[model samples]
Target chain A: MYQTNQLADATINKSESAVDVQPDLNQYLMAVASHQDKAAFAKLFAFFAPKIKAFGLKQFRQEALAMDLVQETMSLVWRKAQLYSPEKGKASTWVFTIMRNYSFDMLRKIQHNKEDNLSDDLWPLYEEAEPEPDYEDDHLMREQLIQGLEALPPKQKEVVEAIYLKEMTHQELAEHLGVPLGTIKSRLRLGLEKLKEKMELHND
Target chain B: MIKHHPESTMIHAFVAGELPASLSIAVSAHLELCPHCKAIADKATKAMADEFSGNEALVELAEPTPAQPVDEFATMLAAITEQPTDAPALKSAAVESSNQMALGEKTYTLPRALRQFSQTKWSGLGNIQRARLGLDEGDVHASLLQIDADSAIPHHTHKGYELTLLLDGCFEDESGRYEKGDFIILNGEHHHSPYTAEGCLCYTVSNAPLHFTSGVSKLLNPIGRFLY
Candidate 1:
């Protein structure tokens, strides 16, 4: 069992209200992970491909590169789905991480003109699955994280993603989101604080 | 205990895959030895996932535009699914690499991130030995630096960002003592002479050469180009 702070509860309730309006992505991912179900994978593709393209367009601003990102990212998701653990985290995170890392390596290749692939060695996809004695405790942390994600308001969540997932600067995010720079900064700070608190709770 | 770690912002950049290869390698090595920072990274990863999920609903809301080319994606999906799963260089590659480095009688197992780099043969200059890790990160240079027992480096400052991650043994400078797994970053501002009592092996990455601040050590500045 984990302790749920007030903010966490509030956010969970808000997302719960919105839950019926959205598909359960985790279920779709689990189907792909356990059964190699192509239908579930297709659903995932339909959901994430456009988002990845949008991210690529935002970053690369080139249609060819954006299309390449979509293809490569979805391909990776298909190959590595079996390695993902729902007890450890959400499917969206696992897929997003793969996309983010692949884009990072692709950008480096284009910028540095290097052929070597360094992302795998730097951030191994199977690192979390390495056998550890405290494997059971990770489930509790996962529970806490599921609740913590709900706790964060949608606006703050968007701000956090823009900064961490998109690697956007405050000014870039302000312009991209069409909000004031000060609001972006404040949301980021608040979101990071909440994230830190959640981590501390897990550590305890 | 590890006394020094990468700054939070750097760790966040690392998690976001924003850092260059050289810096990413150094931070990855440090995270292997420090669990405290790993937790923070994991938390940030979870947050990114949550934020990523938020987009699913938003993308759906903007539907009826018929802009998402479903036919092209279906083609891609069919091409991907038809291929056998045991395709790319995915799993089992991590098991083959030997992660050990030797300097005279001492042998140290390097962090996994550093193991991917094939190190050059160790060459010595006075009491210090350096082995370069050939990573392509523009102006950045990555090396495995080993100082013999009771050896001291000359007082120096960095021209650009310098990252030194202690892999084994212990060392101290003007600032404080560093044990195994300490991640120390120095720039143009700080100047320090580091000495080790027990000999230490460090993974260092820097974009520029060290500038020797002292009199006789200034001659070694020319050698810094080769070392950095």
Candidate 2:
């Protein structure tokens, strides 16, 4: 009973009023990183925990494991908050990267019991070599991304959601959606191109 | 210059954590050297985050079951917040030394992603040398393969899938010539003999043994199982 239409409508509304609420996220992260502010941490948890749980459920498809992912991801966020650099990317993108990496690590561990060899030190952490374009406009990027998602045609949005949120392979997505593989690929390519264009326009 | 790069779909797969661990490592190494792919990957990740947030209300809440489970969340929170006793050592080690491995008189710097496995020793086979990278235990095999200049690998097809990331120099095969930072992925359907003119180093990951397709090199087919 996931309401795709309602979710899209809510996101579209959120995008319209995003400017007032966006800066606070980056500020809260900075507060937690600089002072270990419990109040800020709680605020971050309240905002991200449920979203991460949704992400985990989408990935693991098990409530228990998804909860574990939320716990692990938030805990890492608390410990590594100092590593957050405003110069690199947006607060949401940084948190998303951590959650994604943690989810991948957990999935890998479950599939194979080689935990001893697959230590955290061995995994390549996200390290960008070049300075990201429009780093200072991270909030703008986040707002534009939501607006862009709202702008996609229904079919394109579905394709993008299956690939990004559900982590579905093209073959799997094609089978699930009852579409030809070529159609799925084209939808996804078109969706991403539109998103890129929207973000670029916002940067200017 | 990198003449070839990983396709956008592959990068999306990598970002989504759908790729196998070995292939993920190879792509990570390639990303370190290829900025174009890196930029695309960054955008893909941001888009994914935004998409997830868009569907925020749909995520179900975890309900506590009455089984007397330890408060895992509390335990995790405490574990992460606690300062590690080895913090100093970890801090010093964080500044990774430039890792360079030498083959004969030629030396090449390893990509940051591959530097962690530099301690493993390289084993030689004819003009080719390889070092198996131990990544916990899994069916997928990953290694560094270095072929001397003008050397040719026996013509072969993969049993499963093979992903190669050129770390240095150049090589030519049926597809095209691959330069540094090139990502080459092959499957059971492909058959090619790769030869390098200026020598080449690659990070390769394979799920199954390569089946030799041609001449006297076919005699080494049985050994190909262990070669990768």
Candidate 3:
């Protein structure tokens, strides 16, 4: 937790060895809420900042701007700890909402034009396809999601698995199901929505 | 009478962000001319990102308590809320079906107070039975009619408020094409025939009884009155 000139200078390069806290991000967020824990905040800052940066660069196309957005997003998260209703959404969802909400605002201000911040060393998120799913620890989550899907009504689950998991084209799915294309699509939308509600409840 | 035509399939693709640049351009142009589609597209755009890859989400490493996380969420939410507040979130995630689908833009989220139905033990009615979120059940009971795409609604009139939220797909009325997330509020004065283009899942919450357009629809009267 030491922050001096040397530590500040080397932290980024040494981040490779930064303790990975992928296991208890939600707990960490709760800790921040329980006690104004600066350490926990810093840990979160180090972890999410990079991801936020990548997302921002996608929207703004500038490293500095992305970084600024990250800083702002994290700062907001820090301030909104009281509103962290785990019952409503997962920690990740809350965090993502912050970024998405901010970007939406930024998009509005920029009017869909690319932000020309002219910074070096950054990459757009979408262009660099997301990393392949790592099953190492996320298996529980994946299973939980699958189980949740099973718990949905038969029709709803069918639409969700087909559209979201299998990525079946609507027409293919419609023809295959012998239902109208519109019915398939609407069912898919409704099914996922139901699943999201269930998942949020399970996590809560 | 809308300036742009709806393409349910393209909208589905656009929502998934899988449509080609050319298709996207056309969809985007259509969205500019159409607000309903814009609304559905907006939710689907975000939902798609959330579904495929939750990269944007932050894993909960530790819990923040008492904490005093920053209060920035409110301001940002306020800002978002301020951005035209015309768009409504989908009740259940709305499916885009085809990439060319165009959605509606005036959905209003029902308040928790209004959502009083048990998730368990719900029934269907005439292929569109609702689970009664306790919500507009009274009203919904009166006018809840869901039509598959390309199917025709009885083309009825209303006695009071007819608020229709296109949960998925769309139907055409004299006013125009109504798509997912689009809200159509009709009063007793308005009368139109609503037909699903191909297949649409519409959630029409109405407080008033639907007076059928034709005398033949009057046959629906004896039974339909009890329906409401």
Candidate number achieving the greatest lDDT relative to the actual structure: 1
Candidate 2: CAPRI quality band? incorrect
Candidate 3 on A1-204: residue-level lDDT in tens? 222333334444434455422223444565566654555565566567667778889778987778668766776677655456433334555576666656644653454243421110011111112223223343577777878888888987887776665455565466446689889878888888887887888789
Q: Comparing candidate 1 with candidate 2, which one achieves the higher TM-score?
A: 1
lDDT of 2 by residue, A1-204 (tens): 223344345435655665323334555676667667655665566568778888899888999999988887888677667766554555677778788878877887787754532323333443332323222233565667768998999999988877875455576567456689999999999999999998888787
Q: Which stretches of candidate 2 lie over 4 Å from their true place?
A: A1-20, A61-64, A116-204, B55-98, B136-138
lDDT of 3 at A140: 74
Which tens-of-lDDT digit does each residue in A34-102 have in candidate 1?
667776667677778878888889868899999899999888787777666544455677788888888
lDDT of candidates 1 onward, in order: 0.75, 0.72, 0.51
Give per-residue lDDT, candidate 2, residue A116: 35
Interface RMSD of 3: 16.4
Total clashing pairs for each candidate: 0, 0, 74
DockQ of each: 0.20, 0.13, 0.03
> Model 1 - which docking category?
incorrect
For model 2 the local lDDT of residue B51 reads 71
Worst 10 residues of 3 chain B by lDDT: B111-120
lDDT: worst 10-residue window of model 3 chain A: A118-127
